[model samples]
Target: MRFIFKTDYDQDVRLAKHGGHVFWYGLLLLFLLASPWLLPEYWLAQLTFVLIYSVVGLGLMLLAGFTGLFSIGHAAFLGVGAYTQAVLSNMGWPFPLSLACAGLLSAAVGVVVGLPALRVKGIYLGIATLSFGFIVEEVLARWESVTGGNGGMHVKEPSIGAWKLDSGEEFYYLCLVVTVLSTLAIVNLLRSPTGRAFVAIRDSEISAQSMGIHLARYKTLSFALSAALAGLGGALYAHKIQFLSPDQFNIVQSIDLLLMVVIGGLGSVHGAFLGAIFLITMPQLIALGKDVLPPVIGQAPGLQAVVYGGVLIVFVLFEPMGLYGRWLKVRTFFSMFPFYRRGMFKRQKSFQKSDRLK
Candidate 1:
């Protein structure tokens, strides 16, 4: 086991807690920087998808995992960003400006959604968001003038000035830079007062209110920030796929994004990347299984969905803390060795205020 002896208050919020973190993360960074040369083109492409989804996962994690907000329509924000980027890029807008507009427009929509969100929570909030998603999908499908409607839209390659990110290698580096900056931004946000306010709200809105946290302002802010990140991810996604369709950002995509955060491990930044990896690789894994399994089972149209659903159920029931949580347990077991206890990380039961009143 490792222990830290902190002499300063700032040490508590330091990004790197110890030498181990620095060493491991530094090594990982070095490996990622060189991945274009080390990985095959197909794998590199998949990794790029992973990075894009990771950005989306981080946004979802901040809202669902930290702010205790549940959304089933986040894909709407994604679509907003995607269409915005697609339209703007096609109009000869620079990549940076288009990307910024995508995020900003998504944030604006998020604020609108957040207005309704202030009145609801739990499943009701989910339903409201889900409805919003459906509305956005309909708009995308029918609004032919701006969005290209059901025919879809083609996105140009992202370029800054005269330099175009035309190759997979160049695009991968761009994604890497964005993902790194997004990760750092989230990490720093979590270290700030607003981030602490988010955690407080997640734990208990009643308690957070008692502590003078303006519920409406913060909630709206959370939605805007979350939607902004989702939009940014969507902007990247549009460029990666270079095409956009209304169906691409439908309910199923939202569920997949939610599943990514949950399976990756909610409430942990590491979970976002881990979940992205799982999300990106899962379809490939299913494809590989098709060759080995019986044709009736493996070749079924719903096989991938069934596998995804099964994995999600297993994670929710048996590993709520997610992949990161499971990793923590294993790390603790090995570190503690003979002294390890089975129930050391067990969940605690708590009653709601309504239940207590009864």
Candidate 2:
């Protein structure tokens, strides 16, 4: 196994911990830079969706994974962002301004939702968010003046001054830049004191409060940050799809976003991207399965839903830490070689102080 002997705080908080990390990440960057030229147009569009979903997954991960908050209506924030961009763009606003407005609007709504969240926990919090999502969907459909209602609205291609990111190749570069920047920002945030506060809240609220962390402030901040990221993703998605509809941001979409983070891994940034990739690619895998299976089974009406539910159940029950956790196990096993023990990664049974007292 590789080991680091740190001499200073700089090394402790360095983004790349080792020379190996820099080399591998650099190679990955080079591959991403060459992707547009290497892949077909259709695959490029798929890659764009993966990046967009990754943004959404990151938002959910921030709250659910990092801050111990549960939300089932993040799709509402995403809808708000999409509608904000579509409305502003149609009113002759610049793409950048519209996108910024989308994030701000979503954050405002998140604050409102978070107010109720402060008083609730667990299933009640989920119900509150779910209700908010329904309200947003109703507004999108009934308020035809703003959202175009059930008919939907079109989004113009994003452009900066004279340069337009209208083609698949051009848009891929835009997504790549945003994704990299966002990933770096999150990595930095997770290393900061504020990030430590979030982890504290996740581990134990009483302990975090005793340590001088304001529960209300940090919880609200988490909601706002999560909503802002979802909004940004929604804005990009609108421009990429060139259309917006209330149906697109319903409860189902929110569930899918949750699945992305849960199946990828909670409390890890890398898990978000891994989950997004899995979500985006699962449908294609099912399509491929159709050719191998019998016609009747392949043409089954609810097969996709069944497969999705099955996969989710498998991950939740068998791999509680998700795909990223599995990767860690494999990596550690190889690193330790014959020295690895059978129960090295087993979950330990333990009780919290509150639980023990009770």
- On lDDT, the leading prediction is 1
lDDT of 1 by residue, 197-302 (tens): 9988988899999999999999999999999999999999999999899999999999999999999988888898899999999999999999999999988999
> Considering summed lDDT, which 10 consecutive residues are worst modelled in model 1?
349-358
Cα lDDT listed for each candidate = 0.91, 0.87
Clashing pairs in 2: none
Candidate 2: tens digits of C-alpha lDDT, residues 1-358: 7888998889986789899999999999998899898888888789889999898888899899889898998899999988998898888788888989998999999989999877898899999999999999999999998889999999888888778777888888888887887788777887789888988888888999999999999999999999998998898888889999999999999898988899998888889999999999999999999999999999999888899999999999998778987887788789999998756666321433111100
Off by over 4 Å in 2: 347-358
Per-candidate TM-scores read 0.96, 0.96
When summed lDDT is taken over every stretch of 10 residues in candidate 2, the lowest stretch is 349-358
Candidate 1 lDDT (Cα, 0 to 1): 0.91
